[model samples]
Target: MKQYLQSGIVGFSLTVVALLMPVNGIAQSIGSDKNTLPDIGVVASEALTVDKEMLIGDAIMRQMRGQAPIIDDPILSEYIQDLGNRLVLQAENTKFPFEFFVINNSAMNAFAFYGGHVGVHSGIITSADSESELASVLAHEVTHVTQRHLARRALSQQRSSPLQIASMLGSILLAAANPEAGMAALQTSSAISQQMTIDYTRSNEQEADRIGIDILYNAGFDPRAAATFFGKMAEEYRLRSRPPERLLTHPLTEKRIADARSRMARYPEVRLPPSLTFHLAKARLLARYQFDPDYALEHYMAVNEQGNYLVKEAARYGLAIALLANDKAAQAQEINNELLKRDPNNLFYIDLATDILIALNQPQTAVEMLEKEIFNKPRNSVVVLNLANTYLTMKQYSKTIELLRDYLLVKPHDQLAYSLLSEAYKSEKSYKGMHQSKAELLALYGAYPNAIDELQHAYNYTGDDHLEKQRIRARIQQLRDAEEKLRNF
Candidate 1:
């Protein structure tokens, strides 16, 4: 129901590699043979036979984590979870467990993985901003899972074996068993698995859209919200000057919009709650993604009461980010100062202050500010990272290592944190610590494509005598080859 995103690095890379992975002759022909695509009955039959779709869902979660961290908020998650469950109550399959998660990316996208796995982006949450507007998107994604679109596609890979099934089940166990090993394997293997998902067809998307419209009506949400969202995306595309059809989409074309409009006219529609989040989310996105910093800033400045403080801060941050992108340092600094005055202790504000200082050549002030934040929140991992980066800017290599050591205590599994930590250790001439940290980082985040620049510094410090260096190097090579193969997709 939602469009796939990150077509360049994340999506394309795996697609490129998967295309090269040899498929059986029958498998190759089946994809081309639309006639051979399984019917709904057949798909349902297969789905029933493999009741452990839960395992597949778990694997998908693991693979997702390997690539990036999803934004997790307990209260918001609970809100979404309740909404999803409420909708599912009337559906045929009451036994299936459904999960909805928010991926923390700025890109405006959402998707359903095979099984009942569904994800919305933080951007979508910010974009929808309203219970009803958000519900419309959920209605669409839920339809994908409810209709078994992915399982039908699985049947397309006709002649899939038991081993494949075993691997699917084993995937989550592997991730749980050795998260680092599994994550590394995923970075090495994810492209191959997801390649099939993208080029795949979906007769089900149309079916889901049709069904979702009805669901929206029944749930007391405006059916028009669906078309409204599609129109919103189209408007975004035009305003941003994105090439026509740059994103392959369905249910958003002019005909689709017209069809929705006609359908809306036919239905005895109920009024929707005047949702407040759509414009705010849109404005925030503009601040983050648009090329014109000044315009984005003006847009937010004009609409002071449209959204919450978080939304306002986010908008301001995005505006400042846009200014920095355009190399407007002085203006950006002014904006940061304004924000800092408003939110004196906000972490993001502090981070932006650091950026402004860096741009202004006030490295010592940056160091002082970063140090204060780090000291005030010793257990906070994200803040410590900001401090470490500031240390790197100040060339206080030893201090960088010390702060990284503190951060690792709370966030051992964060690969970037560990990678940065290893760099700090190396800078301090602590070769043993560097060696240990690099191996762990590689094990967790994958060693491919310049695994860690800090690891090299660590090696320089230790005089390259570390025994684990070769293993890390070999893994890095595998990651690089895999990454290269994925580029074509």
Candidate 2:
């Protein structure tokens, strides 16, 4: 699987560069503006087509999902996607749909790939002092996609060898997922013109920063958060010999910080209300991924002792989660109970409380809690997924299937939901259902060939069921066609 993914990565990178190479007219125009920034409008109008860009983006995302430690938590994924979609609504010239993902890495970095896919590291979320700061980072990455900066650079540097461009892009995608491997790729790729690439990237950085501030302001976030976050990154970079992955790609400089501050000064000072979800998300990341459970428990306990009420509450939440991770379910339950009393409607509290009930072997209580939430928010993915999980835990296979089938109709690509459905199918001893669910799960991870094979196995297992066999055959054909299309790329 590793080798298959790596080969796909190389092929996709090469295809992206080849498709982005400038035509004769574009090449001539680039020759005249060799010293200036490429006309973004010209590149936007005439460079890589949207279809090809989506294909490239999809390929890169699949490879990353297969290779990286992506956080598959539905609650966190839904939170980030909601935030990103809000910003996307206010963004201009958004040619593609935006998708957000969280990487389970402690390094402070966020990156945008082709087709509006943005990924933020868990560390960046935990490091943020305010929601606006996190929004600023996301806004910057969104601008990169909106402006088509990567495609423009690929076209402008078409004069370079194809091998060089592919190597550079491969390194970038790798760096976005794994910093060490990316650094190694950079060091080994002798064909790349390091200075030239850096200069181009620096220019794109400035443009993204300028436009990102506008997006942040328009989206009702504090624009100054961009400058604030940049300043913080700069200070951290100075103190460390090896800066974070963000500095490695973004390359913060004094001029950039000054320019951001200058731009932010034009907007009126408007303070937005704090978001509870932001605080909860940060606390969750810190508790779940950043430190050992015992250390996180101690750390949050110390933090809770001296902070303001909001901070203290957030710290308490983190401490509770850490305690739960350490298997102290009773203590965690107490904390969650208090939190729910304060805000019963908050999904964060409800979800954690449900998990606590399950951990304590009180599935009936969890069922009742989630059932009420699902009644209020019938179509909420987080609530639905949690309820499905609760049902699965109780060995209520039919209820699990019935609940998830409707939800998956709307969200067919959700791997976690499909995984739960697969378990439910196995518990019910439905071989064909199990194989079909497994196929869908594999397809979500971009293993199309494997998915086709799964369906073929399902077809063989469906003895004397002509309709089911025919359905499996048809699904296999669709998977094959999809695989062939990607292969052609």
Candidate 1 C-alpha error for residue 365, in Å:
5.2
Error of 1 at 232 (Å): 3.4
lDDT of 1 by residue, 191-268 (tens): 336433533244544455555666666666777777787677677777775522213433256766676666565446
Q: Which stretches in model 2 have alpha-carbon errors above 4 Å?
A: 1-42, 157-172, 175-200, 308-310
Best TM-score among the predictions, by candidate number: 2
Q: Which pairs, if any, clash in model 2? A: none
Where is model 1 more than 4 Å wrong at Cα? 1-109, 114-139, 142-148, 155-158, 161-203, 206-224, 233-319, 326-330, 345-347, 361-382, 395-415, 444-489
Model 1 C-alpha lDDT versus the unseen true structure: 0.53
Error of 2 at 165 (Å): 8.0
> Cα lDDT of all candidates, in order?
0.53, 0.73
RMSD of each: 12.0, 6.8
